[model samples]
Target: MIQQFRRFCAGLIVSLSAFGGFAGAAENADLLLSGPLFPAIETFHLENGMQVGVVPDARATFVTHMVWYRVGAADEASGKSGIAHFLEHLLFKGTEKFPGNAIDRTVKAVGGNHNAFTSHDYTGYFQKVTREHLPLMMEIEADRMMNVDFNAADVDVERQVVLEERARGIETSPRAQLSAAMDLALFKNHPYRRPIIGWRNEIESLNVDEIREFYERFYTPANAILIVAGNVTLDEVKSLAGKVYAPLQNRAPAYQPERPQEPDELRMRQVITVRDPKITNESITITFRVPSFRTGLPGENEAIDMLSEILSGTTRSRIYRDMVIDRQIATSAGAYAGSGARDDTTFALYATPKGEVTLEEMEKELFAAIDRIARDGVTSDELDRARKRLFANAIYAQDSASGLANILGRTLIVGNRLEDIRSWPDRLRAITPAQIQAVAAKFFDPDKAVIGLLRRPIDFETASLKKDPA
Candidate 1:
């Protein structure tokens, strides 16, 4: 169970693919995507209000289909922290029409791949199969959407599975523990602080009634988006969707995402330290709250994305070159701007010290590097290299049709339009070296930071990491 969960989080599937463009915008998506007509983007809505998006790639004979539900960790009821995730597992358990492993058996027999995933803002199920099997994929997905069997025994069985997942994924690892602690300190009132996997106590206590209510509420047509990418046309997709999905009623409950609002995080330097016997390398991570794609201006997301690359994206990155190669204070150092977020996001910088180098020394050196970037700013050469690399990767990403499908699914799910997904390169290209430095100085404030340490228990004993805090 632990091994399975580790692999899941390690790749950390974020369907918010951030990949290629919509082949052509559907007529309905033109108003929603809100821009000039794009070449291959096709978007529409079913009679029942389920938004459908198509990205045609004649290059391949296979297709990737995704159904995204607008419910995730942030949408669960207060005491039922893991219900959204639990439902993701249970949804696969069966429905009356596709009873008892039928979905899995059929997919395996067809030589297709299928999986589901959950994140802070949404849960999604997807299947990839040859173009000829697209309708069959739709039939099964559409059937399960309306007829999921929320059996009591299934709930109890999956509850234990989630507990095992949490234990293996979070409880045993020092880094995972540190990351969870950092989340708790980062968001004040937002449900983003809660682990998408849910706490063990909450997972154990969640019952069938809560799961059923959640399923009936957030899994409706109005709350779902269907994304198809491959050798197919908008017209064929519409016809198929009309037959398969249009039957599901577009019922809007009184539920609008009533998530808690997070207050301004004004505190300077919150800290969480975890001591575990299994921990080998002592590490420190610094997280700063930043604007998400949904809130930031067009250029802001691109600027920060470039900023992460310029800071610590490669061996040539400033932090890596300075600390790992020149100064020899750490073995590795990297910076990242969190992606696929609906609300606010965090910018993270992490490093692990080399032998005989104290974590204190590593911390001082790491901060000095960030402070230098904030103070003097970065040069055009560094900026150009980072920008070129980002664009190059974006171009490379377009090769995979399924990859592009994943991107479209994530973009639409996160309250973003298809136009911007198509225009991602222009935005990244427009980001200036000054803008990168500006976001650096603006977001990397020492006062608005959460510092977390994952250290060996012996080191904690010698140092001052005395007590564990809630």
Candidate 2:
């Protein structure tokens, strides 16, 4: 009996190992050597000059219709910050063919979901629904693309909504407020300094005419890409797109000049204090300019990504282990590289210092970690873990229909091929520890960083009164 049990245990171990190996192989298979594993997208140009991309996936019963416009907050003029995001909200208010709430009602009745967002480089609208609702989704999206009704009353309503959103997303959160301030102080000539939701004053002052003009100028077929995925054939998508978007006349694309580079940081530190009754603790955010996705060298970009992961990629990361868990100086600490399409981007180190631990102490430890990485470089074990985590995330990203749409749309907007997305992991895997250290030494210079602090306000009035008006 003992001999039989041992044999069975050995067989079970072999079976489990085989299963694990097969699973790893399946995940790695999606990491294409040359391009994405997805079916070759059938591209078409409609009569109205709108570009269409179709990827047919018949495994699921649902479909995703996405419209991507080659405009974002970066397209906003000096004073027109947040107009792109504001306009995103206005598109849903109403249109000539369909009144306000008509599209929402139709989508809800069909058990579908719809939403849109604006970024630094693009704006997009998308819908997920049963295959039979493809034509309806396309028709409604096309109608709003060119025929949106930006009436005065609707503008007023959405303006308030956006303001409330800003208050929640920016005003109430010290971290977000500090981030906004850092951007404003960091970029003097670039539109990237402008907030995506626009400033409170700008949103309040934006009128109906400005909104309408922005719509007419940017929301055209020539400046847009339509992507349809899941539960549909290329022919069906093309036919539906032709009937819906082909009638709208195309306009010439809008043009914007390249943003100028930011000057060298002149100060070692800057502080911003916001006194709110609801506030509890102090926070610090450090930002440095790095090569953007558009112009970064192949190795440089990968190293930057790896550097971010090594410092703040997970709870086991250096910052979390040293500052938060071991020293107990900070509640949280991490680093991140902002994902953008420009030629220059920002890398940030943010932390919320704990009680009795000044922001300066937290900053010291954070920089120490960066300095150590620059001097000694990351270990092979660290590199292997980072690569494995990144690979897992890549596979997980493919599972979301909307996420896939956004990835493809954003990449195309930035003038990159879909293959670049698929080949990212192999590129990441090839990065050496020496390259990662070199990138840190090159870009993460303390003198080149913008440090902003949010703290409790001092009681100046009470202090002055106590000093006999001195």
Error of 1 at 251 (Å): 3.0
RMSD of 2: 10.2
State the lDDT of candidate 1 residue by residue for 146-232, as single tens digits. 889787899888888888888888888788888888888888788888888888888888888888888888888888999898899
Write model 2 residue lDDT over 285-381, tens digit each, in one string: 7887777556677778777777887787677878988889988888999887754454466777889998788888877877888999999999998
As a TM-score, model 1 comes out at 0.89
Q: lDDT winner among the candidates?
A: 1
Q: Residue 101 in model 2: shift from native, Å?
A: 2.1
lDDT of each: 0.74, 0.72
Off by over 4 Å in 1: 1-39, 253-258, 459-470
lDDT of model number 2:
0.72
Model 1 clashing residue pairs (backbone): 16-410, 23-40, 23-41, 24-40, 24-41, 24-42, 25-41, 26-42, 26-43
Q: Which candidate number has the best TM-score? A: 1
